[model samples]
Target: MAKHYPPLPISIWRHPAHILAFGFGSGLSPKAPGTVGTLAAVPFVWLAMQYSLMPYLIILLVASLVGIYVCDKTARDLRVHDHPGIVWDEFVGYGITLIAAPDTSYALLLAFFWFRLFDIAKPWPIRVLDAKVHGGWGIMLDDIVAGMFAWVAVQLSYLLWQLF
Candidate 1:
């Protein structure tokens, strides 16, 4: 059965939290909003690459912390828990997946693939967290875990490429 959600008011665009949580309109895509939101994050990842590791980490930490609140508030306002259109989690997840990744197009593409794979697949404990957790923390935690899994995959892939 197809699930029906409440229609989002057009005025939601005026709200800062809605703007951020909806990924600056990337999440408004009619299809695959999560994928579009992740792609939207690619440019930010490019910018973050200009910073050193500590600064990049700090930025990501702040983004994650802020994401929890924005995502929660948006969900509450929409009266929907973890609505598909709320994709700031996807933005942060993609960023986390690419931390310290090589500043190359291929590397960026690889990280994107790995991040999407883990996020969509939601293996093991990620699935556990998704099922058991709730509210904003629940919305963000599973994707954060997926990002960590993708981060490991990206690093290992780079190491292997270097070795060969």
Candidate 2:
């Protein structure tokens, strides 16, 4: 489905925040923008994993906070709230989803699939939060929760692999 994203012409790409909020242009994909944005985040997730866990956590914390502002400002600029093109939340969420798993490509792939499923399904409280939240939080909260679910799934998958 084509969301009411503003036309991403040269003018839209001119703004740094817009570019960031759009997942460095990955979010602009006409089909499955969220998926594309999450996929684009894998490299970042891997890069962040090069650091120790504490630093990675700190980095994500800062990124999440920054994402709120970027998402908010970009939405306002586009005159469309929670537009599909605004997928910084997906970047943050996907990164968060991989946190509990090993940094190997297999683990990252698991996180990616589980995160995408929970994100698309919007199970339980995810659906509830999406309905009630607004603005930047509205755009982010559901995906964060989905990331949490995916985290659990990723961790479990890791454990199961060890057990076998």
For model 2, the local distance difference test gives 0.85
Backbone clash tally for model 2? 0
**TM-score of candidate 2 on Cα atoms, chains taken together:** 0.93
lDDT (Cα, tens digit) per residue for candidate 2, span 32-69: 99999998998998999888888989988988898888
Clashing pairs in 1: none
Candidate 1, residues 70-151: lDDT per residue as tens digits? 9999988888888888899988888899888878899889989999999888899998998898888998999999999999
lDDT, each prediction: 0.88, 0.85
Q: After superposition, which runs of candidate 1 have C-alpha atoms over 4 Å from their true positions? A: 1-3
* TM, every model: 0.94, 0.93
- Candidate 1: C-alpha RMSD after superposition: 1.5
Index of the highest-TM-score prediction: 1
The clash numbers for all candidates, in the given order, read 0, 0
How far off is residue 127 in model 1, in Å?
1.2
